[model samples]
Target chain A: MAPVTMIEAIREALDEEMQRDPAVVLIGEDIGVYGGAFKATEGLLAKYGWERVIDTPISETAIIGAAVGMSYQGLRPVAEMQFMDFIACCFNQMVNFVAKSHYRWGGPVPMVVRGPCGGGVHGGPFHSQNPEMWFVHTPGLKVVCPSTAYDAKGLLKSAIRDNNPVLCLEHKFLYRRVKEELPAEDYTVPIGKLAVRRTGRDLTIATYGAMTLHTLEAAEELAMEGIEAEVLDLRTLAPLDREGILESVRRTHKLLVVHEDVKTGGVAGEIAATVNEQAFEELDGPVLRVTSLDAPVPFSPPLEEHFLPQVADVTRAARELARY
Target chain B: MELPEMKYPLSREQLLDLYYFMRLTRELDEQLVRLFRQNKVVGGLYSSIGQEATSVGTAYTLEKRDWMAPMIRNVGGLLVKGFRPRDILMQYMARSGSPTGGKDGTSHFGDLQERHVVSPISMLGDLIPVMTGVAMGGRYLGQKLVTMTWIGDGGTSTGAFHEGMNLAAAQRAPFVCVVENNQWAYSTPVARQVPLHDLAERARAYGIASYVVDGNDVVAVYQTTKEAVERARRGEGPALVESKTMRMKGHAQHDAAVYVPPEMFEYWKARDPIARYETWLTERKVWDKKTKAEIERRIERELKEELEFAENSPLPEPEVAERGVYCEGCHTIEARWERPIEQLQPPKASVQAAWTVSDFGGTNGGGAAAKAHAPEAAEETKPAAVAAKAAAVSTRGANGGTKRSARAAARPKRRR
Candidate 1:
């Protein structure tokens, strides 16, 4: 009934899912007693107890690998990475095993690896990261980055219920920043559907996660200048809502993608290429992107601020595209 | 410890069964090698030649509920766990009807539900954590099951080995980590791989009970693994069993093993597990020449039937490649995006103006949400200035200064 923070929404989703399904469990460092580095999993241990909310050692390989094994035994495990930057440690497990298990053997790994991702929190290279592209490039994995609390809860519920391994990337910047009134009744946002956060006519700003907020701000700023910019939230990266993206681009005839991940090899490039291949005739201007610099997330506030794409950056990109 | 006086833990029938399994595995390895040489096999064959005892012995001790994560050299273990030889042959032949559905050939085969086996990942030691988690999940679910996973001597050097073992030990998971220290990790010998003489000693770092057994002795391996499995089922936590054997052949059929020391090969060859077990069985009067001949003939007939089945199995259709990349009911991003753009929903008009920080609840919320952004921060900086700074940074393009040539130039010159 009331608006809840993204972190709270995530916590509620885990809490409700564990209650709904006995097979659902939680495993991660400091997740049980410490709540979590960001407290996304706060009160989960207290609610579900230790057996369901397991506190694992600081071993990402073991955490992910064990989650894969647990999935084989019919248990739905939601493993937290504390911070998404550390997920690189278990890259082999995720890329080689978890991502390939379904394709390799037709086995369904009903597991979710959720954690606070994205820069802007000044967590440096080790804590702040938008590594969704890594898993997006990997097949057999569903990647989700919800911008609002409602989507955070709904998408997580869907991810937990889905048979494939899903990477739920929560932006650290939006954990407490984004809040929305959620329905009391249980609901799940389908993994492949795109949410049209704000509709417009002149141009389309296709983005997700924290960038959605900045892009929305940019859209509002452009709207004052008589430019109606549509904001499309790509809730799920892998199994991307291609229909939503193409349709928005077709109407606006202009596209500007935004993301917090590094520009090189980011989802922005993929979207640009897709539009270029499928809707090249509709485009009145070149597809553009406002993404982080191609470098590790700097720890200093100023450097991180410069490294990350801001509202002003999106506004500049959207205005330039609107003119064309 | 000295080799225990060939005590029989199993009855005559079980012993005969074990002997038959070992003989069958040995024959299969020989057949695979011959097939590979004749250019009939699809992939490189990695045999369990001298290490059949280790696989058969440990796998035989596992109950139906227990799971075994085997490596390429654990075909014997797979067979002992009730994996039909014909299915294994079908897998190697890359038939559509194979368990892997021609997805993976050779030792990359497993049946999680039917056979209780976790499919192997080629990145050695990775399966250790997987097996540990399976056991931990089993214990948590109130199932009385023990999980055993195999790794090579070289695998112990990996970071995953330590992580998996430490997790298993700390969690007190019902896991048995079997390190098949068959001396060589590919071409690298154990002596060169680690400074320590015994790999079992590494387990002490995790504070788990460890044992080193004579891998060449089937009875010793079975007895050692049985005790470890019993301890695990008793909730005593994980144990490390190092089966010290040697790789008598090259890593795979492609390798001629010219690098191997002739004397070293001869030494391990003299102590072949199958030959030693045959002698032990004959001495105990549990097996005779007539029984051995009959068993060999039976295995030969079975091998012929399996070969025919593999030959008769059809090759997968070309379209099958696009399938099985994801599980059934799973929709890949590529598949969804492949649809034509015009058929999708038409974009709608904007419902509102630009969104502001306040809309995200800077004032409406309290505590962390309220203090989420520093007050007056927006007024302090101009949007034009920030946009200018961002534009300046964006000009550098995605490839920054980490060019390959630059990195190579930074490397120190090597000494001749």
Candidate 2:
């Protein structure tokens, strides 16, 4: 298999799923003819036809609602948000309807609401957001953010096949920047599992999405300075993979959570709390977080660099945690 | 009251069935209210006292294979769709044997496989898009089924309603939306909710056909919905049937509806749907006094047994609440494909690659201009239950009414 970008991997996952399962369909704004705003669905409309590759109105509520409905009729619908920030438009449908359908009525809402998220391209507040925590806070919804092309393809395939609603948050920054060769045979990276990106001993830096790249970069920098920081990619957020976090923390004796989302109500807080509650005795130092400031994403390059946790931020945080 | 000349081609038996369902709906609500007053109901009770006709008539037009999602007040529709009184009672009481296994209360339960009923969400207009999806999904799965859902005047104001309706119209999805313009949405009146007097006009913006009918008139509701369902089944796209009626009770049992003027209640009381239908049946000689009495007796007896069964059903175990959050090998959902499954395969599923650039000439692709690529036409199969129902009505003789009544008197209703 040849090397593929994260966007290409996502497109292949959708294409293969549609080919394998007759019930799979895609719905989103400008997804059919205009090929998606990000071109994640560039040629799907031509390949699958308009019936399967639906170009829905600019109605997030309808896109998600219709996908939930399609799931009821046994069709696996992969809906796109154009940008994840617009998912707020259909929050009621996602939280009140899709998330609670199974608990409320023993019904299965098997669908995926995937879109590009995270800040780095200066998309400002609306277009750039790490909104995985919104659905992560919701029960009955599985949240995943793939940091690499392999996980992006494999995880997306798993999300489509899962019998419950899953939110696949793809970071726009890593869409083209991250590329890797995938296996020729079909495979799926299981949901609710974390991936170990780098092996070390001094400290553990847990991150996901595009932040994984920054964390890994920081680990490389720290390794040169004799501070070996293990990198744990928290791939699945909702089912927080506590064992994996605890296992790495137990070995390293220190933990640092890094994320691009804002500090307050961010997933970093949840990770820190999980470590404190479950692995309190295993930790030698307080679980530190290298998260963006508690403010909306700024559009300016310098402001965004300051707002988002850079590789320097992770390195500084990991160095301090390793000393403790 | 003088019943108008029979407008629709409804046989006497079918007319009698409508009356029975309306009465059953009203009677069931009365029992639910009593259960509420007795503190047996786990949640608030929503009474569909004055709006029985709309639910019954529209649901009666649907075949068994079709799907529908009912609002809190559309219990009549649930009954017509074959949900027993015990099911509603157990659901309200949060019994272990309820539809949702005591997971939900009130009319928030739906049966996907057998009855094809989708549950209603607490957020009002959400079902519109969901039902539209169900309609489109069914078409893709090669099932010729029409999907229906209800919305109140206030719910029509939600963004979901507009978005869902537009999606359905754009896809030419086989969907029928029945707007129960029940004058008031919760404490808010329709006047305060929307600028248009008729909510059906909202559908016109989407280029879908719309109708305005007397919701209190059962015959009119049935005929209008039948027309809409038939049109949708014929691949003519979605249609909206705005049935105007009044919410005879408060939004739920908790509110006293103090905001409702006394005159409004008096006005709607005189036009009660069940009372009007009873009078119509008597006037049209469809149901004589004896037949009506027999029907009422049958309803009371059935209600008593169902209520007793509901009362005896136990509450779910505390442990039961911990399970079934995510479908982990517990429930499997598979669509019942009516047409050949191979149609969805490769060469048959291939579509033309040409883009019709002329459709979006003047706009930025936001307009509902190009409704190109309507669902591929499949061989139509008439719903078996609908055909059987029609056959049953046509074959009944003069003594058919008495015969049905006698059979009801002899047979023991099975308990769910």
Candidate 3:
């Protein structure tokens, strides 16, 4: 087994999907001869030809709109937003049309819109943004942000084959950094499912996407101090795994939600609210959260590191929760 | 087409069929307007009215298999392409049997399997790229089919329109981009928007040839569209045709029409498309008052039956509300695999190539296009169980309808 990057896992998933179904087509800009801006679709065009591997114009709106149109026509289209930040251009179509296609027309837009998202490498505000909250607020859309290669490959395959519009946020940070040997055969992971990264009985931690790996490292250090911590990877943010969270909370009796997104209105808030709603009876301490400060992710690395919570922060937060 | 060495010219009956579909548009409009006035239809919309030239004009040139992406006002085009009259009327009345299942209002009337009409979207010119994709799809399937999109003056301002046009040009997809500049976008005149003197000139920006014509004259519209369609079918790529016409009614229901200049109406009114076409045919002795009366009677009788059928048609069951949210059984069974946490491993490739943006067979600037709104925030967020309570924002926002944002507004009518 080889250690593969997150991007490779995504490519493997797409390759498997294209091989499995003729109707699975890829549409995005620079996805043809040039592969992709990041080259995630390097060999797809040659294998699939012009119809299945389509390179659209620079218009995100048109890409999204056409994908919606094609999906309505029964083609399982995987539309890639060249960059997640560019999604703003198609915001209306995604939020208004893609997300609501089922809720509105009873029509399925079984499609995957994957792109480079999040910040760390100085892509700046325009190029890097964590817009998961926007889709989180939207009811019809299902959002997937994979923190590990295994989850990335599995979740992407599921989204591409899904009959609903799925937003897959692939962190630019994890594209090359995260690696794992995906299963040799084709596979899929169910949406709305959670993965428990590391388990303990004192304090529970919930997070997703790139933050999952960070918090797991945090949990390892917390264990050094005899402070047991439970880490839950909330793979699907929109359909938050409440059962998983509540169960973990009931086990640990102390809950802490964490995310790389800003603190206000972040997914942690929703989980916190729900824990208070459904499992408050089991609470032994007020739920704590390790989230990005309420500010734009800065350009400087030092500031960004500080802006984004680190292993020490999560371990410290858990230590306090353990004491409480 | 001359084909460099033609034989006989197009026959009288061929011209008559062109007249035939155009006449159907006029009759449908007249009947629908009267129905709205009688309170039979749910909403009042702008009739193709003075723009029949473009609607029937372009469609008459299409093969049944050739695709069409019509604008909202192209009911004539959709109907001519074989969309059922009852289906459309049912749609207008927001009835259950409508292809959109009684949800989307009449902006784009389309069917993927039938007549190859793409479902409609209403952000004006946004479907240009999509229509281009349809053409590209036709080409990729090696069907040699052309996909045409009908646009208006307002739609010309959209980025999707430009993108679609450019892509079509680059890929040489068989297409016809019809511009129906009826001199009005609700209240603004074409003069107030475009200063190019001719929209056909904009085509030059992309190296695509274009033609201009009087959209009020069905003969001119049909003739020009036929030429463009033929060119596309010949693999010569796309053409943009600007049809100059007028709007005969207010934009839609409750329009004060204060913006319409008195002289402008008088001028276009005297040149009423239906009347003008009828007169043109009659002077040529092709049809007379008696025959016209017979045609009108037939349309009237059929419209009556269609309306009756739609009005009495049963609505979709409230219980089946969740149906069609996705394709029925379009699910791929997940090849589930599970391993204990101990077996988990990191991925192999440190980084991989990014996915290329595939150039779908060819078919921006921006002033942002817009939304499907929920009636109220709370109703949109938390839908009311009572259909009446949530009816205002009830549409699930399919076919690009006005979206109801209140989560509660869109729920299926609950069982007692």
Candidate 4:
């Protein structure tokens, strides 16, 4: 079996789900004939046809609204945002309609709103954004960001089947860059569960999406300095895996939360707050975060690199946390 | 004012059913207003006193298989869609037995199982795309069903409305959008909202058909909507029917509507839908004093029973409020498939593009100024041949009764 890229893994997840369930449909801009902006839905149109692979107009509100409506009719629709940053355009639909549907009416809105997110590929402010915090704050919605190819496919498959609105934020930087030979059989990673990417004892580096790769790289760097940093990929952000975070913190006695999103109001703040609330005694030191500066992602490679948390940032944060 | 003779294919019972539903809608809201006065209604009570025909008439065209989403003032549509008067009263009162189980208030309740009614989101014009998706999903399931939803005059200005309309048109989905141009949107006039006199003209930009009808004229609204529904069912894409009417009362029970001119009220008062509909029924000898009195008496009796039921209904326990946020095995939503799924399989489901170039624009152009009830007014106001073409697609249907004496007392004055 050939090793598949994260993009291929995601496409496989969608292809397999559509073939397995007739109710699974895809709707997004450039997703059908254009094969998606990132080609994540490439070849799906020809195989499943247009009804299942819908090329919607550039209307995020309608894309998500239509997905909600489709879900109401027992169709599990996976609506893609051409760029997840444009999700702000449909914020009202997502928050007010989709998120509140189940709570307000007990209608199971089984739909997946998946798209590429996060800054690292020099996609700039509009294309590169980690907007999961918005949906994370929303109660009824479940948010997930997969860092590896295996988790990308597994988590997406689970999200599609889940009877709630799930936001699958794929890191654009890791889409084709990360590759792994996946199993031949079907599998799904449970939502609201974190993945332990690497095991260590000295400190725990909690991260997700593209930052997971950087965290792992930083862990390798930390290992050279005799500091064993365990990398915990916080895949699901909304229902933050508090137990998993505590268990890792309890094992390592030090926590260093890392993410590509801006530091202010980022997922790291929630993770820090959770640890302080539940596992305050278990922590050997104060919880620290390695996150991007609170500013728009610049287009310049150097500035964007500066704006995003890099491998060095995690290593530096983990080193400081280990010393603390 | 004399109305033009328009042939309608409706039975006497169906015609009376229209009147019954409209009167029921008005009577139910009047009762809700009374409930509001008693501090039973949990939220604001919106009165559809004047726009009953627009909601009831347009919604009446829908078959049981079709889907419809109603806005706040479309309580009449809820009745027409088979929602019990008690279901609505209890919903406003936030009782446990309400359709939403006291989770929501006002017209924010839908019957997905039986009536196929999609609940109205507080954010206006959001349902347009939702119904469009329903239409699309229905097509994928190989079911022949048209989806409809109502939007207000102000709501038409929403980005969702434009985007949803475009999606419907581009996909050639079986979708109908009723723009209830009831003059004002929470104190702002339609003129203040948009420069266009006819909101239907907004549909032309999307390359879909649009129709202008006298919303107060129940028969006209029914006929126009029926035509649009048939067009959508035929895969002619979406159609926007702008039902021109007025919101006779304030935005809700809380609003005094002091911004509206006294003459404006008197003018629309002279053209009250129920009064006009009664006159239409009487002039045609469809119902005499005895029949009208019997219908009114039955409505009163029905309202009393439903109100009692609503009052008797228990409030949801505090613990119950904590439940049902996510599916978590609490509820199961299964779509009723009327058609087989095999048609969506492979060869039959294959399509070259998302959009099909339907004959939607010229000749029998999608735009029409349908003057079904207004005849002998002026040469410029004559019905277009397109309206006749649209009529050839559907059969026929019928609108309201009266203002309650409690309405004036229920309405609160605006605070300075």
Candidate 5:
């Protein structure tokens, strides 16, 4: 109904959910009168009041720890780790307490933790990172990295509504840069389901979060070279959409995995292995991946471009698959 | 406040709770040893066999609402924390009916909604953060409640211990961080966990208060704990109370204590705190030989009851194995307490499907049939940030609930 930035759509989702469910509360730093650092929580404090839209101290541990306790006590608290990179600060709370809560205690930690993750701007290594693989490795945690305004709004709403703990990684680069006409009314996107963003036959490009946008761009560009790339936006990471992945792989008979995370130990490695194990026969070329180099994302603009996976890299990988 | 002095002598009732629980610990320990021999209780047990007074004295003083996190070795702490001896037995065997429904082993215990007694776990001092969070609950809720967590001298080596105390002290949270310093940590001793002479000294780092007591002396432990709890209730933050005692048994059932040198072992046994307390009470004419004999006999009987009950209890059913994993009951924040979906959907539907499908989406629903992933519009991610917000102000604060804020800013602005 309205063409909104990914930021407003998320703010709308939070405002609406908070309005519909009194049990839904927000816990993060500077989310109150200050709004969010990115203003995703704009007007929330004035609308819901501070009691509902709390601004916490700069303690990720406290944010996540409080979320765990709040979730335990029946509040669907949405905890935000300001920058995804700083998540290492509360690694134990996330991996040990929140993630393991369900499997460890047979309790559902029905809380959603959303944050600005991934780097495309000159935010540097410290600020700009797609650290999805960390939580992806954890069992109880459900990781979602949304690249579109639609997926961002829908998934944020769904993650909040889900009965389990979910981590929604909003690519920092996509927050303002991305725009789409989102549904005016309420909506929710179920987690653990992959989306087929564009149809193709030559090769399958599996990616998520910010990388989804890049892969799509690469797909459109690859079309000029007579290669059709079927792009699978793996919105959910932990519960990888293997069937969707295999289907695309089976159809194209080739796979080209892409992600912003470093190549080694990224989501691509797991998917490639799974395809090898489950859909080994459905192959024409080797499963290739275009990912960030193992080196930390450089702070310099030009160097950082070389450091991360760009549209060209995805295109090159797809071209190779097309040739094979 | 005097160095190693007892305030009020432990009373008959207090003594009985301690003695009986100690006896429960004793019988449970003996049973584990037998079980080990029989191969029933797997893994070497970390029993509170000898250090019974330490666990019982601290836990018995806690009111029903006082939350506790016992260390792995503190079986007495679990038993004394109102965990039925049967629950303990079921837990040791990892049965489903046990508090952890057999999902956890002998140590990992928990039942959060109940009187906050969490089972002892072994990331060493990991429970400290949970304990601190519980204290945060007390502070936020404006309750006189205190969270008491038992850690071993060995647990001092863990980061959680420091993180928990630091946070508690910084927030002035109500917490009694008890260090059951029974001389040895799995045969390594205090010299290993820390170089400091006393674990109590570590409190200086957190800026919380500290107290050291004879863990074996029930009166001393009770007195020290009372002071810590009182200080904690005063919002003075947390206390690092180090109860220096001796390990009566090895780390667990099979430990021959080969690492413990004979001379040091003899010295610790010579100063056994329980026996010393018994003699002190007797010489004061508070308890005579016949009375002491009767108390021991009474504890023995109670121990028998707890053991038999535990041994006889049924194992948990398999179907509900995933029940409390993350607390489906978290949805219950009201009188009717419907799931978020139930609140929005037709009420009649919830009633009809109550027994079959869970409140959330069906487990077996294909992405196609499921509401979110059906070949329709791609679902957005809010964790799904539900665009359909709930009514802003219904049942905001009731029950033992605390309201920190209405809408806590949950996430950052998406950086375009």
Candidate 6:
């Protein structure tokens, strides 16, 4: 079998799940006839017909709110946001209603909000964003960011099957850039497990989403300089893989967190604080992070490049940490 | 307009039931206000004092399969849709037996499965889209269900209101949007919310049918909403019915309503919905003084029993806060990440082995070659080349007489 791109993997997962469960349906703008802004939902409208593949008006509030109503009626709706940046429009529905419905009334909202996210695509502020931390801070939502095609397919399937609200943030940069040969048999990656992309003893690079590629590249660069940098891909953010993070910190004794979101309230800060509190004794150096600047994603290429964390940034951060 | 001597569409027994439910809702509102004054109720009371006709009339038209998304002031609607007096009282008391399991102790209570009622969120106009979605889902499932959602006059100004109305109209969804133009939105008068005289006229922008009725008259409200509901169920599309009424009380128990002019207050007070309904019923010989007194006594007795049940209901246990944040059997909340770091197993062999470049088909350099490469040379030189290449491509697209340039040049300037 040939390796499939992340977009193909996600589409295959949606197709298989919709075939496996009649309750599963697709709802979003341009998802039906247009096949999606990025074509991640290509071929679904042809297979599922109009009822299952709905083309909704440009209303995030209605899309999310309707998904919640559908979930209440025992349907598993997989809603697309075109770009996750527009998800802010439906934050009230997601945080106030979809996330808390089960907690408030014991009505489990089996729904998945999937979209292309991250900063490397030069989609500017409106299209490119890594807003997982916003949902991570919100309770009653599971946030997943898969770097590999296998994890992208498996985690999405699991998210569709789970009886709670899940935000599947697919990196736009890796939609076609990353690829892997997925098994023909059905499989699902558990929600709370972190994948150890690389292992080492000198230092650990903790990251997820598109940053995993940069972190892995940095590790390759660091390995040449006699520094064995381990890379930990935190697939799930809300119910974070605490065991994997602590285990890596214990083995490497140093931590460098990387992400593409702004620095102040990003997941890196959370990881740094966690290591500082739980695994402080094992650390030989201060917990450092390589993240984007504290500003909106700029549309220009140079500004965006500067605003995002690059492979060289991770390599430099890893080199400084390895010495400590 | 003169009070029309219109014929009643319902039977005598149905008219009596409507009267009884309206009276019950008013009594419950009065009780809640009394409880609030006595410091027994947990939150401020939002009463449906003079607006009972709108809720009762609209909710009475709904079938069991149909859904009603009510606002905070729709206690009458909730009562008509199978919510017991005891259930509402228990909810206000914040008891363990409440529908929200004591999580939300205010007016945010509904039984989605039993009565198809969407619990209200605090944000106005949010439920419109939710109810529209419910209607869309029902229509897709081929069910003859119409979703009715209520909003105040001020809520019509919200972006969500426009979105919901536009989507419902565009999709031809089975939805009935009822705007309770009760003259005030939390002390801001109707004139301040919208410049137009009639809120129903706003529905014309969505190309949906619209109607305006005297909301103080229960029969009128029932008739107008019945037509809207029937039209929606027939898949004709959404309709907006603006019920013109007045809020006889302040927005809630906490307000003194001093902002209202005395003349205006007296004007609406004379057209009180419950009293007018009583007069209409009495004129038809369907209701009499004896029946009214008996019904009042029955409601009073029922209220006493429900109040006792609520007051005696035990408070939730301390650990109950830890529960209900997520669904049962779902993943446990990782509270503070308390697992011991030392007990976890070491890195697996598969992950350690996958780190080598050989596993990646060696497209990139192996360990030794990557180490000997100068870091500055590799870091500084590669990205510069890529940036230059990208910049040249973008510049060509911008100025080289291409189709992309025409689109970019023709693009309108965006607002800040």
- C-alpha DockQ of every model: 0.17, 0.71, 0.12, 0.50, 0.07, 0.15
Question: Candidate 4 chain B — worst ten consecutive residues by lDDT sum?
Answer: B404-413
Q: Per-residue CA lDDT of candidate 2, range B157-177, in tens?
A: 888999999899778799999
Better of 2 and 4 by lDDT: 2
User: What docking tier does model 1 reach?
Assistant: incorrect
lDDT of 6 by residue, B206-309 (tens): 76666677788788778667877876786666788888888888888878889989898788888888998888877777877898898999999999998888
**What is candidate 4's lDDT per residue for A186-300, written digit by digit as tens?**
9999999998989999999898888888889899999999999999999999788999999988999899889888899998899889889988888889889889999988999
Candidate 3, residues A27-108, lDDT tens digits: the string is 8988876888888988776665555667766878778766765565456678888889889887877776677556444546
* Alpha-carbon local distance difference test for all models: 0.80, 0.85, 0.72, 0.83, 0.70, 0.80
True-vs-predicted CA distance for residue B58, candidate 5, Å: 1.6
Candidate 5 C-alpha lDDT tens digits along B78-143: 777667767667677666667666667776767666656654445676677667665654444334
lDDT of 4 at A165: 90
Ranking according to TM-score, highest score first: 2, 4, 1, 6, 3, 5
True interface contacts retained by model 2: 0.71
On residues A1-324, what C-alpha lDDT tens digit does candidate 1 reach at each position?
788999999989988887677678788888866788888877766565555667787999999988988888878899999888889999999999998887776666889999989888778888888899898999888999999999999999999888889999998889999888889999998998889989999999999999999889888999999999999999999989888999999999999999989999999999999999999999999999999999999999999999999999999988898888
Model 3: share of real contacts kept: 0.18
Candidate 1 stretches with Cα past 4 Å from truth are B1-8, B330-416
The candidates, ranked best first by lDDT, are 2, 4, 1, 6, 3, 5
Q: What's model 4's overall lDDT?
A: 0.83
* B1-416: candidate 4 lDDT, tens digit per residue: 23344444566787788899889888887887777898988878888998888899999999998999989989999899899899999899999999888999988989777899888889988999999998988877767899999999999999999999988866767899988988899999988989986787787677666777778878877877887888678666678888878898899888999999889888788877888889988888888899999999999998999989988999999898788778897657565666666645565655454333233434554443321111111222212343446534332211121210000010111111
Q: For model 5, state the Cα shift of residue A69 in Å.
A: 3.4
Could you tell me the lDDT of residue A35 within candidate 3?
84
**How close to the true structure is residue A220 of candidate 3, measured as C-alpha lDDT?**
82
Clashing pairs in 6: A224-B371
**Tens-digit lDDT string for candidate 3 (B123-228):** 7766777776666555544466777888888789877777778777655667888888788888888888989756766776665546666677676566656666
Interface RMS for model 1: 13.7
Q: In TM-score terms, which candidate is top?
A: 2
Task: For residues A47-152, write the lDDT of model 2, one tens digit per residue.
Answer: 7777788888899999999999999998899999999999999999999999999998988999999999989999998999888888889999999999999999
What TM-score does the A-chain of candidate 5 achieve?
A: 0.98
RMSD of 1: 16.8
